[model samples]
Target: MTNKPTALPARPHFSSGPCAKRPGWTPQQLATESLGRSHRSKLGKARLQHAITLTREILGVPDTHRIAIVPASDTGAYEMAMWTMLGARPVTALAWESFGEGWVTDAVKQLKLNPTVITAPYGELPDLAAIDFGHDVLFTANGTTSGVRVPDYDWVPEAREGLTFADATSAVFAQPVDWAKCDVLTYSWQKVLGGEGGHGMLILGPRAVERLESYTSAWPLPKIFRLVAKGKLTEGVFAGETINTPSMLAVEDYIDALEWAQSIGGLTALMARADANAAALDAWVRRTPWVEHLAKNAASRSNTSVCLVLPGLAEDKVKAIVSLLEKEKAAYDIGAYRDAPPGLRIWCGATVDTADVLALTGWLDWAYAQVTAA
Candidate 1:
């Protein structure tokens, strides 16, 4: 490890998930007095319900839609949506990254849903054509692996007969989501809110709820994954109550994250923080010749998962620089995904400070010189 001065900030954790909480966040916000109560009890219900309401208000979700905390992380919520809502009609799956690819595989090979797969390269997006309103649409709002995102909902045709299912796992806080454009949306706490992962948030529009009530799944629904009971949509589940027992501590942490977000001026402020961080990185990348952005278009780039590619560095050399940064405590967990080419993936979300991003970029320049010189 490089011998760097170790004066720590008030808080500095940069893990991809379970990220550092917002600045000034404290554990004291949690209701330690209610720790031992049953989640199904009145106290737990009230606490959890409040969280659900706050989440809706913060995200600008409509009153007609219901939000639920489901079992597992983002993955489970996605699978539940797929299993429940897919195969009702022909499906179009849009993929630009690993998660999107995974969902496509599940639709074709696993569930045997008759689906048309549209794919794009790491830096490019597929043609928005061939999207028929008669079929369900599956897409990832933000491509976490490549750090590319759809510029807006303009790609989605206005007159659509089928539902739009979007996996906005990493895009929820940093990017603006037009809830009207989607019938089903799934996200986890770990990404933007920096809360510990265990539960996934699933939001359902009126159309999606109607489908859940009317459509019969060819496959049996597990108790945890089922959204309907007695042929009726369980709208109450979205308000923090889960199918199974949830970790109260985790719930408390999520509540704290939400409260912190509100305290810091809510979504507008959070988005500004993300924009500032991305802009800081963008300026650094423009000045540095040895490195460049992975995504070809600046407008399509992500503010949360910001990826970059080295121009001439070998795969091993790129890995070396990432290792050096982590060892020196200049950055943490900045390596590119294994499937992606050699580069870096910086989490430039709301939880990160712009100044910290600048500091890390400066270290990147120094680290590159030392490794290349050797």
Candidate 2:
């Protein structure tokens, strides 16, 4: 193995969630104009609306879609959609990782919906052909834990009778989502945009709106989950009228991130940046002897959260390597998800620099050698 590299990544923030901030980001970079002001004020609401508009623009969302800043992060957005729109049809919940499994738990235990659950082990995709699209389908677009992603939307039947609810928290902005196949899509700013947490963005297409207008759940709907009132969709919710108070600071932070996205040429540029970061690691993984990508298939490998499986290494040894890396200040929060098979999880989202990812591979090699030599 090579000697410990003298050079370190210029930036080492690689946590999958609450990912590294946009390039050149600093706390002072955020706009303070919206702080200390009522969220209901014209300026504050405009800020929220601007975030909504910029998000749509960057995402290339359809004109027919309704975008809302919802309560909580991506989970809240998913729950809101499930609570509001399921039971209209038979349900299908697909799982290949922890987050996908969480949706299954909600479907079977909490919502009490007798949905068909199709799943696979870590680092593999479930049989997409076996899915019953005649029923409501809920799944995560990217498996952040397993380093697996549903390759594309080609598997979703075009003539299906159900709506597709995609939890794209880790995929949006970094991956191109086939909006034509997705009806209800949700993401949080903390993922790709590198913004503050506590806010979720929910986008509804025509079919989703149709379900909201036509279907009503038998369960009790909390005020926060209520998207309809007096027999009509709450238009104001999509227009930046939030159900509860929101942190204006988080709002402004998201706007700043969105502005950064725009400055870097929007979604296309963002995907390229993330792809470059992942490619840097991929090039290294190709030559690495002791470790490999957790994702077994190249087609399903995620570009945003690149999980790696140490082929012959013990999980404890992997943890020790991670601890060593952290102690050396070479990386931080790079451990695999607790629920996932033990390995390494690196953030290759757009906010992370490609140079840093390249530098990280060298440290991984050094750390691996150091651990094994002991």
Candidate 3:
């Protein structure tokens, strides 16, 4: 029988969303001046604007693109883009996971756009070459539930008649994005940044803005989804005036995460941290006989939200392993997404330390042995 591991991960927060906070993060570290103040106040607006500026600086977003804070986290940011801009052209929706499926539902059932739907099963990607760029294309940059990601943006054409909307909630900081190929990209503070939830960031390229000015959706947009007023982009929203009230505390937490990214040498460094953490986990997965990556193509594997499967194991056994780990406090929130295949999902974002990931591997081995032996 394998022995229980003596060592445990120092910090066992492995939830994919609202992921582990940045190393050395604490509530006291957040700026409080903006708290308890009206979001429209001078201090509040300045802080909100500063968050947008820091995001551009750290992410290297070009001046040609506009960024804004939106409500309801990533889902809100993405749906806002869809409800406003999708009906302008033929639309193509791609799905490889639950979130992607949600967008497909929105396109087909909600908006009644009758979009062309392309899908691959979990752990796989739809054929990139098969997509028609003449139509508006929507895809998730990373399959957070399935551990699959597009290796790069080279497949997306530089010249296309349609807009490309990427739900990049899990990919923004950890993965490299070719901004020129994307017209609309949305993410939330709670994903790779490990900040508080309930807020999202929307990035609009020149093309997306042009669409907003020229095309109007057939459906009446909700007040929160309005990005354009009087046939022009709402410039103030991009400049820190939000359509709805925002949580100043959450805003402060996001700013803190962004500043941490800047202090650690910016985007390149953030990507490196995530890469190292994933590499460590991958190494263990390779040596372990029972487990394998859910994503078969290594190039398509996600560095954040890495999912694994125990071949031949029953789903109940997989759940048992997850329960054991949590009971021992060796790991927390590492179970696979409910809709995903039964297995494990460990977050390897920039905020996670490689040493902690390595330590968790030992406990995984112990947990596997305990669960399978019964």
Candidate 4:
């Protein structure tokens, strides 16, 4: 009953992080960017400003919310928020996967903050219903490693006591975030959008700003992590001014990506694209009994980084199938995260075409058959 797939995917770049670039992207597209110039110069400033403006317009962030492009990737943005803001209140760190667990470690081990740690194993969600919103909450919007995402913000009470920080590096653009319930959200350009890495974007709602001005961490703050001075928020950081030197080339590539986002509609369209891409693969998974989604709850499953668990296959068999697919140039970097349970992790973000996803499934089946028959 096994037959090789007749057609190949038109595009096969699908790494979850630094995911596939916008269709037809090449080095030639960056020809007009400011090169070897100071980011503070007028032309560079305008380019950076354009990126910030389009981001705000497309994402529909609140008027009071502030967006900043900072050094390092999403990790820097998240760590900045944690170092500057977490000690303000008793914190609640939630973890169902690796990135979430990283934040928990930062809270308890690094900052030495006494906080409540709530956790769940892979393939299951933490008890979102039981979290005490009275304390400052920290959670990832999507678990890139395990492929679980919070279905919605309805679980959080409206008039809760403390701020909510969301590490949404993999969630933005692919999933709709209810920012009304969120205080601090952080992401990098390299995720949903196929932009260059090396920078992070931090979006701060009104309450998040207020916390920055009002609270000070007991631990020593590094220069890069400092977000306040003279007991007031550094407002300049939000207005295209960065805390450190940023890659002008990366800045331009991001601008191009943002413009591409605009041309295709806005966040609504981007999310729809990701959903459709995920659906294509999901349909195939439903018919394939050997594999199932890593996220046990259907509602909690991620549409972007779709993780799948092989029911009874050994790790070596899964790795061999991954190697076969890679050797055939049918898929790249679809292996599950190293720490996560043995499985396949596919990127179905907006940048990924549904046709490619549909094509990839055949390759998966072919690889599985090749491994099983041997």
The top-ranked prediction according to TM-score is 3
How big is the positional error of residue 176 in model 3, measured in Å on the Cα after superposition?
0.5
Instruction: Compute the lDDT of residue 359 as modeled in candidate 1.
Output: 72
Q: Rank the candidates by TM-score, best first.
A: 3, 2, 4, 1
What does candidate 2's lDDT look like per residue over 1-374, in tens digits? 66998988888888999899999988898889889988899988898889899988999998899999998999999999999999889999999999999999999999999899999999999999999899999999999888899899999977879999999999999999888899999999899888999889999999999888888899999999999987789998998889899899999889988899999999999999999999999999999878899897999999999999898889999999999989888899999999999999999999999999988888988998899999
Which ranges of candidate 4 are over 4 A from the true structure? none
Task: Identify the leading candidate in terms of lDDT.
Answer: 3
Which regions of candidate 1 fall more than 4 Å away from where they truly are?
1-12
At residue 170, give the lDDT of candidate 1: 88
User: Per-residue lDDT of 236-354 in model 1, one digit per residue for the tens?
Assistant: 68766778898888888888888888888888988999999899999999998999999989889999888999988988888898888777777778888877777898888898888
Preferred candidate (lDDT higher): 1 or 2? 2
lDDT of each: 0.84, 0.92, 0.95, 0.90
- Of candidate 2, the 10-residue stretch with the lowest lDDT total is 1-10
Q: What value does the lDDT take at residue 108 in candidate 3?
A: 95
lDDT score, candidate 4, position 44: 76
Residue pairs in candidate 2 whose N, alpha carbon or C atoms collide under 3 angstroms:
none
Residue-level lDDT tens digits of model 3 in 33-130: 88899999999999999999999999989999999999999999999999999998999999999999999999999999999999999999999999
Taking all chains together, the TM-score of candidate 2 against the true structure is: 0.99
Clashing pairs in 4: none
Better of 1 and 4 by lDDT: 4
Scored by Cα lDDT, where does model 2 land? 0.92
